[model samples]
Target: MTGIRAALARRWPTIVIFMLLGPVLFMLFDMAFEQMSQDPGLTLARLGNWIAEDVFFVPRFVFMLGALPAAVVGALVAWRDSRGLASGRWIGGLSAGFGIVIGIFFARNLFIFTPPPLGAQLAIGARAFVSVVLAGFLCYGLSRPFARPLLSQEER
Candidate 1:
């Protein structure tokens, strides 16, 4: 639709930033997961082996290789979007909304596998609700500074 395209046109930089950094963020998270996947003793053994094999380079490799491009691209997007208040607000709010939506999807996945302890489930659901609300509020707050100033400038 024209509306969707127009909106994207206005916030393309933010979208691209999200796209570019998303993978790096994902890989960062993946590294954490990878570490978790290894048992402590096993991890030590592997570390020893890496050193013995001269591959102590493994973990550092991922960090060094993956982090820069992602960070740079993300920074570029953030800088571009930071140009003006109006577009910045729009971009920030939408990004927050998207994050909350994604959080909901993750919550749904968790709900199905969640233990059925009645009170616990209630607590989890409440926590999820609170998290979503907080995420939305965070987005709104971040946008407010940009939006308010932009609107005031327009009025003048």
Candidate 2:
């Protein structure tokens, strides 16, 4: 508990900044993806509706259940990155965290309101887990270049 607390205390500013910005980024990405994909089927209202219907909806909810684990992973990455000028681990971790953040936000919308058969809940859970893991791995793979420079001692 203390270790996490300390990490939070040290990293809180960065974490909170990213956390708060997450929704804005989400909206931007959502809109951008919609536009780029030219998905006429999606609208802001429909998007909101999907968000409402999916995941475990809580009123006035900001944080999704997956955010907790995601943030932990992100912090770990960021901490590792902080060790040098650029840490791939940090980007990888943060990217994973961001993926989870985005994933949970969407997943919450998907499963939140639907009447569940136990199987459906299990399915959603499995999908959500896969999405989070994939996001992390993708981020890690993509971050190697960016993180490499930072991780190098020359930068320090």
Candidate 3:
């Protein structure tokens, strides 16, 4: 238990960043899934209508009002986490964060008969993997200027 505590003590910031950024990352992921699928439109429309319907869109008001603000905040969080190499908290936080989302969707289905299609499940899973790559590149790009110089193998 103390081992877990000690690890958490050292990694809390990483974990918290993941917790904060995971959902926004997932939302950003919707665009990728749509690009890959037959219906090449924002999947956010399908999910976000429950929140707000007439906020903003390229052609129409598809994305909800909160989306702009959410995007801004998400960007900030991503930038905040954009230092150093990926940490163990990245994996742990992704699993834990998505677990909560899955739990919420599961509970929602208990009350409502409608369930999201299998594509949505595939998207969620794919997003988990894709997010790592996307976030890693973002971190790499953001940290490049501040990163220390690398050396040849002999230097190590």
Native-referenced Cα lDDT, model 1? 0.43
Best by lDDT: 2
Q: Where does candidate 1 stray beyond 4 Å?
A: 1-8, 11-114, 148-156
lDDT by residue (tens digit), candidate 1, 1-156: 565454345544444444444443433343333344456633546545544564344445533653454344334444444453234444455445544544454335444354557664454444434443343334333333322324544597
Top model number, TM-score = 2
TM-score of each: 0.33, 0.39, 0.33
Q: Candidate 3's error at 78, in angstroms?
A: 14
The segments of candidate 2 whose C-alpha lies over 4 angstroms from its true place after superposition are 1-14, 21-44, 50-69, 85-115, 134-156
The CA lDDT of each predicted structure is 0.43, 0.48, 0.43
- Order the candidates by TM-score, highest first — what do you get? 2, 3, 1
How much does candidate 3 score in TM-score?
0.33
Question: What is the alpha-carbon lDDT for the whole of candidate 3?
Answer: 0.43
Lowest lDDT block of 10, candidate 3: 57-66
